[model samples]
Target: METMRVIDKIRQLIPPLSPGYHKGQAGRVCVIGGSDEYTGAPYFSSFSALKLGADMAFVVCQPTAAVAIKSYTPGIN
Candidate 1:
């Protein structure tokens, strides 16, 4: 059995970006995980989504985790 090339698969999965696109229009993602001692997970997940061109990314977590996430980036709110 033959499989598609990695580049081809990537091209199919990720859409191309248009010029002058506004925020929250490309894609929106929400990561629901985090705790006082586990704040890193949501941070990484939200950041990865943003890096992938997601227009908006949010992380829902406990109050303590929320503070840590915000410390990492004000944009995560």
Candidate 2:
């Protein structure tokens, strides 16, 4: 694919920034997964959303995994 064309197509998919919009109006995402045997899955999903410009990322994981996830970053709530 033509790089510029791909870039333009992606840009077109993004909503225009407007003062009328409030926080999280552009994007909000949640990733829910994790367990004693899979503690990193939820964190990875939540982090991917944040890296992609989501206004908020939430991880809904088992209580046992919460501490590890929280310690990994302050970005996930």
Candidate 3:
């Protein structure tokens, strides 16, 4: 059996960022989850993508939950 470091695996899977790349050239992600009873899960998923170099992250939840999610922060759309 053999093991590889997480960073090594990630580096092999993701392409390097190029200086000439423009917005969204890296990637875009959409997280769909959460509801009136649970909202943080969706927010965490969407924000996680943005933190990982995603150009944009969107969350699709119930209408009522949308308002709650949007109010939580301006970081995600």
- Model 2 lDDT tens row, 1-77: 69999999999998776878777886888788887778788888878877777777777888988888888876435
Among residues 3 or more apart in sequence or in different chains, the pairs in candidate 3 whose N, CA or C atoms overlap within 3 Å are none
Q: After superposition, how far is residue 58 of candidate 1 from its true place, in Å?
A: 0.5
Report how far residue 70 has shifted in candidate 1, in Å.
0.6
Give per-residue CA lDDT, model 1, range 1-77, as digits (tens).
13558768878888788888888878999999999999998899989998989988988899878888899876445
lDDT of 3 by residue, 1-77 (tens): 13568768878988888999999889988788888989999988887888888887878889989988998896445
Per-residue lDDT, model 2, residue 44, is 82
Error (Å) of candidate 1 at residue 54 is 0.9
The whole-model lDDT of each prediction reads 0.85, 0.80, 0.84
How high is each candidate's TM-score? 0.81, 0.73, 0.81
What value does the lDDT take at residue 72 in candidate 1? 88
| Model 1 worst lDDT run, 10 consecutive residues | 1-10
Query: After superposition, which runs of candidate 3 have C-alpha atoms over 4 Å from their true positions?
Result: 1-4
Q: Which of candidates 1 and 2 is the stronger one according to TM-score?
A: 1
In angstroms, give how far residue 29 of model 1 lies from its true place. Answer: 0.8
**Cα lDDT for residue 22, model 3?**
92
lDDT, ranked from best to worst:
1, 3, 2
Each candidate: how many clashes?
Answer: 0, 0, 0
